[model samples]
Target: MHPLRSATAAPSRRALACALSLALFPFVAAATDGMSDARTLDRVVVIGTPTQPLTFVTDTKLPRQPVPASDGADYLKTIPGFTALRNGGTNGDPVLRGMFGSRLNLLSNDGSMPGACPARMDNPLSYVAPETYDTLVVVKGPQTVLWGPGASAGTVRFQRETPRFDAPGLRVQGSLLGGSFVRNDQLLDATAGNATGYARLTANRSESGDYRDGHGDRVPTAWKKWNTDLALGWTPDADTLVEVSAGIGDGQARYAGRGMDGAQFKRESLGLRFEKAFHGALRKVQASLYRNDADHVMDNYTLRDPNPMGPMPMPMASNVDRTTDGGRIAAEWGWGDVVLTTGIDAQRSRHRTRNAMGRDAYKTVAWSPDATLRNTGVFAEGTWTLDAGRRWVAGLRSDRARATDQRATRSAMGMGGMAMPNPTLGLTRSETLPAGFVRFEHDIAGSGFGWYAGVGHTARMPDYWELISPNMGPMGTVNAFAGVRPEKTTQLDIGGQYRGKRMDAWVSAYAGRIDDFILFRYPTGGMMGATSMASNVDARIHGAEAGVDLRLAADWSVGGSLAWAWGANTTAGTPLPQMTPLEGRLTAGWDNGHWSAGALLRVVARQDRVAVGQGNVVGRDLGPSAGFATLALNAGYRLSERLQLAAGMDNLFDRAYAEHLNLAGSADFGYPAMPVRINEPGRNLWLKLNFTL
Candidate 1:
């Protein structure tokens, strides 16, 4: 049997049903052995701190109360101004402040992992197992130009911290999870090291069956996944280090909103890094190189029988793959109150695909290259402290981006199976993009308040999906690439944070004007089912997010947050499509020495202002969505200094609700003939056990 399949396959029901009983046996055994010890037990906290204005950082290894996340997107949704484009129970695409796609620069340990599917069946986050990483960092908006280019929305990084050992030692941490719908998960991280070197391993597996919605209707959201990674590091001294890492993973999922399911999601990755600290003006230097590959398979028969009367009448499958290689090197200098950082980075990626009519036939066919993309960038950022309470920060960057079209013929969707001439065949488009930002920050003396304001400008070259996937082009061109222009955005952001003895609060606001915004238009009912046209237009966007946390007592606390976003298509004279609705979250928690409890109430307002058939590459507005609210409850207990247990119930009321930015459930999933929002999961229960040694 294949290793990937064996790793992800479901264990016998008898074994799964006995998981809890088996887990308690170990707990009881450990408790009896530790009864004579007098060590103080550490309290387990279920809820993490609320996000501040411009940045959010948290320990990914911590156990979250409302059931641990299955993927990066599920975890990111817990932060402010972040939402997921739900398709099913897992692998949803994440949107930040109404922005989607490449606008959000997502990275794993500073490496890029681009998905293979043109429709984004395997988004970058889908491959990320958040709990396997040590830290998750988010930089909101284009307030900084350090990570990469064209990050108009934000940047998200999943990072693993290096371990430093003074003497020979071994460390281990792991978790086990069980829940409704036959959900099961396991994670393990282990490290062995001496003062000179170390070796680390991380592995995880997750699986679930189809879950019933609020009305007892089964949703086709079943999935199975597994991943394993290893790293070796050498430390010659305390201030210098070198490391190498490799990883492989695979998964399969059933989608409730699409015609086809993800039959396979295969991944491979490799990376090398070096860091050194100097005593001179060049205080520190760092360099890293990485490569990632994604091989995805989508089919109509692998997970479910083909619907003879539906759009796809027979067994069919498409295999798409992408390989990306990138690296970055940077040096930092500091003198007194001034600091500067400079770096140069480069990336190259190629995409290819093959399709066949019979099951697994695509594997026998030769893969045809569709597109190749390349980018090289240089950037510099500086910070100067004007006084003890004031500081100024600024940055500038330039990138050379190029894309080559390798297709011999265009997709024959609206053309009735007749291959049409490829307008961009054997052609390459190149663009130079420039981005910069400036900001000023002030700390109110003895007031526990800090304020910051910044302005930024970014010019972004069109991405592969926006340039090549549309069925039709703008009014005058033969294809999207010939007519779609670079996108330019200028924005101003301001925010303030206050920390008091009993309360902490933060609020941020932004306004931006965009020139040559790439917009997609879908004509209703085409011979191809749905055909999209890509065009450019002028636009405006503005939004704000605020959050506050208050400590009612030493053991009790309450927190709430609000996020609202608005945008307009100035040229089209209509509201922008797929905008996130006004949303708020209220949470209260009580934590004692060894136990914790929490409740969360989430409320979202109706979004009526929408462009019906217009949106970004992932999804479009499914008419106006109604507002809804859901509640969740969680609790935790510390069994011992090295063991802890947590449990939670999501959707406490089991109310039926759907998100505004959603894909209509496909008829293959028993949805109505006409498109409609896919309902979210109903009440669910889960329990998790964490152990460290």
Candidate 2:
């Protein structure tokens, strides 16, 4: 086996491991066979909903179950075809089919929460806590237009549902967890309602210490966070409902790849929504508006313990803060067998910065506007039922966006001999983009088999942060992304699903071509040091994913999922960098009346083809990475109707491994000495206690 793909067990021990895994199969089978056929077919377990084939739903209205969700992006990786650009123990930036940032629309309660850091320290999801919301929904690829525009990769929404009651009622659910490496978490959700109105509150706190890798080596990535939200609703009748909601969140983290750490993240959000159901021609009408604000603070001081041997040596500091204010109004109306949806959206964002070398020195530098940007757009989509078993959907959208970069002068440093305060001058850009899509679906077997095909197009404008961020390396240069052109993409997707009493399965495939794809490149010839720049290049990508669940007996279940992806830049006739390798996951579990146990095995194939340079819009590409496989085991027990417990160990075999999309550790972590690409945790132990009342 290649060094990276070596089997965790030696040839001599392989037999022992196999025997152990098979020994428990009989017990699981016996328990599963005890369940009634009716109950088995009626149960529904989902992480997403049916807006699209790739979409999954998480309903917070039900008691929350334990899933290993350390961060917003980490939580998303549970979906097939989804991966993360691992930064540290957490905050791994989410990527879908090799796309990141605005390419994927992320929202909370229908509000925009864009980040400010040039390096994206305050990633849009970093401030979000999944346990604090009522729902988590994700639509993969440009498969739907219910959210917003420029969502070629997909859309993610964290929402809170309104409560209704004909009489008075109250509900409360909470969880507490303590585990290895000083990990601890607390979450609470409560709601109350009367015949005329309702209210809800949610809060959560999480923290963990530096963790040891598979080889028992320490990795200095740790953090803590907290957030809370409140909602009030008015429901005078069964057909009409209105709600007002607000939320706040803040946190700090230690990063192993960047110079500065996340010291403070402050967020505020407000929203209003109205929904009504008509008795006659129209079935329902729904509309909502939301506003979000994010203020971030980053520096070398206070956040993390200072290191004399680190890059700064001295306590240098700089802070960039931004405010994003936006709202969307949409309505969905149904007539007979057809549905029509339309919406408009607008947002304004501004940034300001301050810098100083000494600890408190920067406090005196007057903060001034660094960048300003705005966007306005409108969209419409219609779904028509052509026949009893067939339907068609079509959509169109247009957006006008403007960006202004204001700076006295570029740093004395130059990128690739291109001096600052460029002879070409600062940049101002205004772009108009149009997008559209069409899809067809049909029910093959009325009993629960269906297939669908779709074609989508999107014209995306470069975001403001990417346009003026620093190069972030020894180079001291800046990445002038302002001159970059808008990117356009055309894609075709096809998928099918089958549901039955003993088995359930789904499969999907996609092929796409992109024009002027924005590619980030690192230049060895930096005017000062090493600098990375963003540019446009042509590219094409294709991938497929399939999953199946089988009930071996009434009490036993087995399932597996597989995904494969490939991409190349036609401009250079080379493989695309950071493309996820072919991977597969197998799971086996058993559930009796009061207890459940399961185990998982994940396999990854090596990637030898690479472009040698191109990477994500904000990260660097490490060419052709090796791959491996790992195993995990988990079990849960119900103590009573309102109480439960769960425990699990990931990397059960304690195998040493690293991912293909991993970032290098920093000086504080003894980086190069421990440069095995930051191996995953050897063996992790966690236990959760859940209560519902």
Candidate 3:
């Protein structure tokens, strides 16, 4: 894992002096038992690697569940401060800090992979599987520029590592899952390698049937998908690694809430990366390139029967496709008490669309021209150790991004209407953004105390798709996304950590204000009934997270974590849309020589404050929602040095509840008393077997 440079540029010398002194002030202020020996060591975990950015320290690698993840976002929800927008049973969109779409930089193996559908049915994450990757990283908040720009909420990355062997070796891993509601999944991950190079392949398939609510009522959510990837690597020395990889995936899904369904999601990806460490001068140098393409199709006839209340009330179909490609290169140098890293990155994408009232009309409407988006950036970060117990980190970055609406003409047709072309709305725009940050850390070693404080800022351009496509009407008229401004944010982060053999604790907090925060508001002024359009608005956000681990005894352990966030629009004088609510998790476990068992309890606090209309990325705001809690149990046993077995149950009590940030309730899911909430699964059980050599 690697640390991402902060976005804030620099701190005042006076402020820096104060930050420097206070970093170590706590150690000198107190004298107590068991404190002096514990506070001296720096134990920060490396964050994201260049290829896969957003990562969490806590992981579910050891947890129990069926069905492999299909994308990076799906895997992220296992961590805190994360949620999803459920369309049906699967392929739910990921949300962070109550933000979705372009707000989070979603990257895989060092590249940007945007979905192809104008409606985003094949989001980049739809092609990822966490179990197939060796590592996952997440960074919350607009923390840095190592992974590209416009990551105001943060960055989420999933990556696979190249394998090397001194001798010929082969590895194979597979899993089978089954549970209630006919949920089933299959996964195969295998690799073969020798001293000079290696090859690997991975594939996954999953499907689930409709589920029932607590009241034994049937819900329409259901889904299925498949993905496969292949890779080859070359290694000339122990310190050098190079790899090339390619992958393809496709799937279909049924949605109970929308008029259309995901009929096709085709994905293609290519990537190359190399790393080398210099023995004496600089620490390490790494470079990488990646390209990803998605071709998606949505139709009402493919996934299910047409609904009487749907837009057309008859068999209607429309298709939208878009593709994004991106790459980044970076190097890190370490000398004496200092480490510096520098990098460059770029990305480009385009989109096109066509629609018809019926299947036969598809060929009658020509495809719309593609919309183009491109960006390039440079960044550098350095860390210096002022003394054995004090450290400072500084970083800076700049980017140039441009977007073009390539449609030769736009058409203003009503929903379920014939294609009519309109030529008055088309344009291009460009912007430059810069960001930086500085932080200081101190350890009261031997005192069981340590603390750090940092300030950062980020400037983000509008996402190409968000700025050009989402606002367009089904009839392709009225240009809802014609003019939009970039967004900028400045924030302060501070935290402390405490450790003991029997107890460990940590707390972190952040406060920030955003300028021209890009937002979507329902515009009813247009001739089109109601359409969402992007606009720049001022907003503020702040939050804190805290956790503690305690050893009840030599064989028993207990831990819990809590987080809360508050957001609001100063201009609108209302709460920001889609903000997550207070949540908490608690776990109790017992581990011995060969076996381990554990149980987890999760609780979500109800939310009453809402933007009135601002809701999920694709759904509406239903106001506030009631909170619920669920429990899970897990156990693992080591069969031998080379083998292990594990099993677990989710939603142990079979509680039927929904999250606050949900998609619109569909015929499949009973309409909610409030807004945007879907029924959760009942009790689910799964088991796994592992082998290593």
Candidate 4:
């Protein structure tokens, strides 16, 4: 009963195809390059190197190794210090520095979009289609407070650039990709307008069938996804701006590790923002508001046959949804060599669900409200330029957070398959969390080298999945919500970077102590199978990620990155569960005029440490894992100023392997009931055509 695995599609597929064709006709016919400057074809990115200390910025439109992912979590695997628990082809939850769940603040256009699945089948990153955005920004560790709270791990933002036109015109950029497993994708981003105002639209569709592992065994990893976004903006002056935006999307993903497949994933969003700049001390003011809705449905019958002997023998479906709303306002002030930024932000989210025992039966059940979460925070940051090559930066923030439980009964964790009265029903929990950080950066005079060090502390309230997903609480407690406490983390961060004529290099390291760290334990043999229990413990974690890129010639380059993390539970004197093993990537790329090619080699060391039944809500450690190595090759050719072609071969040797942070394959999918990690895709091939007009 690995939770059931597969997906289903609805009507209007012909309509979807027709709309895409019509929208793409004009762009394809106009094939004139509109770039401001001449460009050469860039090789596929094997691993994205950080651009600054503790921060990474990359163009999301670029091609990547291991073929492009249909979801955000898969795309993020291209960055160091990042990995995802493998579920299937899409919607895998991302983990940074061995941290999962809300420890990482995920945002799109500065607004949070949390999913409704208690087991996180639809994590925040699941809704993000990386290519739809213009830029991807990552701030590692709790080094800044500009975003919202509970970013003890870090913050991730996917942002789209504002469209501008000095004169009336039309611009478009799009791509077509095809790969193994019947994989196909189409993307279109277009804009039209003049200086007074502009209209922009971004859309994409992707689908794939089940893929085979290295051993030629099929893994239930099929999926279909699509999205459409529109934005209208007004840029009246050089320093003034206003915008309105809206988006809608839906998707279905099959997971080999879960008992239920995602039959439906629907989303809707709206937002508004304003920005203004002044000439003097009052530098700028910015404000924005956004609302997002996440609706999801998971069922066993849609994609697979329920095994009569399995834990879930009957057809069943569950529908869940969450609505989130938030707003933020900030102002920048400049005085001499010093600058300051201050802002206040607030957010509210509500979760509801329904379920039934037959096909699409959940549609007839009344929705039940389960939880409400709210948070308000204010922050201030200041930067002082002591000299041309030296500077100091600091920030402080405080958030008032609250959570209310609305359930009347709770499922017993194998206690005779009975429902128990909710002891914490209608109870409200509140906490005031404080966070701050300060760091010093020096450029070493005229040298192209810089270094920084910072200390940060933040208190985080237990998130929904941690408090609500777990079936049990600490001993002697009624449930997770009534017993679990907020976690407090104090960490030290250090990093340095060098940018020379022929080479660029960077390295970052961190160590942290967590008070009342949240931990989930999976106990087997329950009436409903595996059950999750939540508790708190004292823990310590440390990790480092480093990389260097060197140019062998004007058109040839070589680079590599390494990341490793280690943690320990002080309370139990055991190694941390679900920790990522030591991993490294090596790449060689060449770009000559109109043609480009590259090769990437990735390696992972075996992970022997274990606390087998303990991990986050999605899964627990499944014993020790053998390490593996994989390779990929890519080539690209610029056909003209307006179009380019790129192709790749991943897992060149067809090596079979599984990640340490992955969920156990479901018994319904033929996996042994003793928890076997799902294997990754085998050798695969793909081709992509990119165009701009």
TM-score, per-candidate, Cα-based: 0.95, 0.88, 0.86, 0.95
- lDDT of every predicted structure (CA atoms): 0.84, 0.70, 0.67, 0.86
What digit string (tens of lDDT, one per residue) describes model 4 on residues 1-693?
222222113213533453355345445644565566434446677888877668889888888888887888888888899999877778889999998888999999999999999889999988999999988999998888999999999999999988777889888888888777667789999999898889999999998777889998988988888999999999997788899999999988787888888988899999999999998998999999999999999888877777677777888889999999999999999999999999999999999989888788899999999999999999999999998878998999999999999988888663114678899999999999999999998763458788999999999999998778778989889999999999999999998888898998889999999999999887643221257789999999999999999999999999999999999999999988889999999999999868999999999999998787888888688889999999999998776666777889999999989988888888887988677888999988888777777
Give the alpha carbon lDDT tens digit for every residue of 595-676 in model 3: 8787778889999877755643365455687889988887766554444456667788888887776665543223532334
- Tell me the number of clashing residue pairs for each predicted model: 0, 11, 26, 7
User: What residue runs in model 3 are displaced by over 4 Å at the alpha carbon?
Assistant: 1-55, 58-61, 64-70, 360-366, 409-426, 470-480, 523-530, 667-676
List, residue by residue over 311-425, the lDDT tens digit for candidate 2.
5677777667777777777777778878888888888888887776777687788886767878888988899998887899889889998887776554433222233553223
Candidate 2 residue spans exceeding 4 A from truth: 1-52, 60-67, 280-283, 303-310, 412-419, 422-427, 470-481, 524-530, 673-676
Clashes of 4: 7
- Residue 99 in candidate 4 has what lDDT? 89
For candidate 2, report its TM-score: 0.88
- Against the true structure, candidate 1 reaches a TM-score of 0.95
Model 1 segments beyond 4 Å from truth?
Answer: 1-53, 412-417, 525-529
Q: What is the lDDT of residue 291 in candidate 1?
A: 95
| Model 1: lowest-lDDT 10 consecutive positions | 36-45
